[model samples]
Target: MNMQVWASLFGVVLGGLLSYLAQFTTVRVAGRNEERRQAAQRAEARRAERLELLREFVTIAQEGIRVAEERDQAPDWAAAGTPEWFAAGRSVIDRLWVAERMIQILFPPRLYRLARTYASAVDHVLWRLPDQIAAEGSMWHHLRDPQHEFLEAARTELGAHP
Candidate 1:
């Protein structure tokens, strides 16, 4: 071939190879960036879900505590059949049931166990409170430490505090 024709052919081939390499590199980098962005979005979504569950669980627990406290303040002789007593008891039980379900759904095994234990403690307290109040004349002595333990575990699991 003539010198100019050979040079022209070489230039064309070199240009095509460079263009292909540039396109390949761009596509690979863009794919990796997109993958990273998607992963980050998924992580954020999970964190938000966990936080929302924690908020709901805490609210239910607090409501249960309030009901229990109210029952404790009632007169010791208040019969269980009374409307006030029945309503308070029902409210506490329902709240605890919902909280337990939330824990089972949202918590890891360790945290779930902690929450269950706390629920059991609350249940025991509610069941025995009336008799204890009548006998002891007060509701000052109850095993409520499990509630704090559960709260601490939940907070830690949700990455809310330290």
Candidate 2:
């Protein structure tokens, strides 16, 4: 080939190679960005699931507290232990047990420990005699401190607070 033709051929090949490389690089970078975005979305979804689980646990535990208080108020609760009272109390405890197990499985060690502490406080209220509960006043009073600690830990873990 003549010098002009050879030069033209070289330039065409060089330009084509560079264009192919640029397109390949762009596709690779785009693929990586897409992967990162998908990972972030999955992490956020897991966080949302954790939040829902914690909320459910708190609700069940609070119900337990309410049932305990109601039992304390009943005149025949401690003495006769009516079938209705036992049934209500048993229902709360059963649900609380399930929630506690879930917390144990899904939460980190610190949160699980705090949750157990709070559950213990609830148990104290439930098992206490009427006179003992009366001595302390409201059932909420018994649960307030432990519940506060548990919620604080949960909020911190959930990144709800800075």
Clashes of each: 0, 0
Expressed as tens digits, the lDDT of each residue in 44-138 for candidate 2 is 99898889989898998988887786777777765646777678778888888788778888889999998998988887787787678668888
lDDT of 2 at 29: 100
Model 1: colliding residue pairs: none
| lDDT per residue (tens digit) for residues 4-51 in model 1 | 998999999999999999999999999999999999999899888877
Candidate 2 lands at a TM-score of: 0.85
Candidate 2 residue pairs that clash? none
Worst 10 residues of 1 by lDDT: 136-145
Candidates in order have lDDT scores of 0.72, 0.85
The positional error of residue 52 in candidate 1, measured at the CA in angstroms, is 1.2
Give each model a TM-score: 0.77, 0.85
- Candidate 2 ranges beyond 4 A from true positions: 131-138
